[model samples]
Target: MYNSVSEKDWVEAAHPVSQNVRSDIAGAGCDKPYFEPLIPEERPDIDSPYFVYFGRIHEDKGCKTLIEYFKHFKQKSSNKVKLVLIGKNFMNEVDTSDDIIYTGFISDQKKSFYLQNSIGLIIPSPYESLSMVTLEAMIEGKPVLVNGYCDMLKKHIELSHAGYAYFNKEEFCDSLNKLFTMTEKEKAIMSKNGIAYIEANYNWKVIIDKYKYVIENITKP
Candidate 1:
């Protein structure tokens, strides 16, 4: 499959193939960020650590990949790692494991709690037409570790210096190890970079200027 496309078609979908084609070209273009606003009631204590997975729970979307790798990560690290699975089930018996919350189709408020609290996300999809999950992850200001196979997210991760993308299950495990290995200094820097990248590129507030250019050009005679 082609890895990229023109900017024109990214947001301008003339037909069904339009969005898919645009996703290739534009690479999660200036879509809205997925950061959830924090509510007072559900905010976890600031010190607790967690990870989240948002989007469909289908096989291709990497639900299984996160489950298996997190199981291994839990075995390898003493750090408390909570996995919040947010969305409807796309398969059967995804897991029977510790600290795994399969909240079937989370509400908006619950989603914001997870978004505000979690360390980051594990997006292991081998293939996606386009990952709205990645878009939201970056928007939410959470770092993401996705699969290298998803060319769309790979481009964003590389361009925005946002997060890591593992190629195989082993690589996924290695990514987990790397996260644990990070010193507070390093994590802080990466977190700064992540937030900076979103502010500059993904945050809808700053980059809506892109739309003006798009509109100017598209409406030009």
Candidate 2:
């Protein structure tokens, strides 16, 4: 099974020995309570009007590039938006300033709090098998901003219509600007679209049924 179509394609083309690829993205099932949106009173002390990134703070994950792009956005945009990083810091870099706050490995509750309230989640990673962080944000009815250069990330945004994808600094800055200026109704619509997409495509029950079908077919004469 392949975690992404891009990965499957690469393996088939490069290996030449692989065949009959079946796609199986990461299953989406979680404790309902854990993912439920928190009230304003219950949210942690994160700055409002922010975009969040929840993965390793490593170069490979595009953490450094995200920072540079965000800083560039801040310089020209009038919005007081911040970028919150909520994962372990592998770069050994100091978490600095209110503009780019680093929580450095927060709990699921707090992470959910950030995700549910933020403008949207931002993923700059150029490589991914399956981005569980992106799926989790979608499951929580939030939009996402992902790297368009990554086939998997780009596919998710295009298929879901619940977010934007950027291939470079110009696109990245422009997408965030659009997100900042979006109206409440527009954002809500995106939220619903994201949730519906997740339910239809990633639900574990659906995944299990697919797995069972594959197994049965494999054992058949």
> Largest TM-score belongs to which candidate?
2
Lowest lDDT sum, 10 consecutive residues, model 2, at 24-33
Q: After superposition, how far is residue 188 of candidate 1 from its true place, in Å?
A: 2.7
> TM-scores of the models, in the given order?
0.72, 0.87
What are the lDDT scores of the predictions, listed in order?
A: 0.66, 0.82
Q: Model 1 over residues 123-155: C-alpha lDDT tens digits?
A: 777766556666666666667888788766666
Q: For candidate 2, what is the TM-score?
A: 0.87
Candidate 2 lDDT, tens digit per residue, 142-179? 88999988888888898899999998998999999988
Off by over 4 Å in 2: 15-42
> Ten-residue segment with the worst summed lDDT in candidate 1?
18-27
Clashes of each: 1, 0
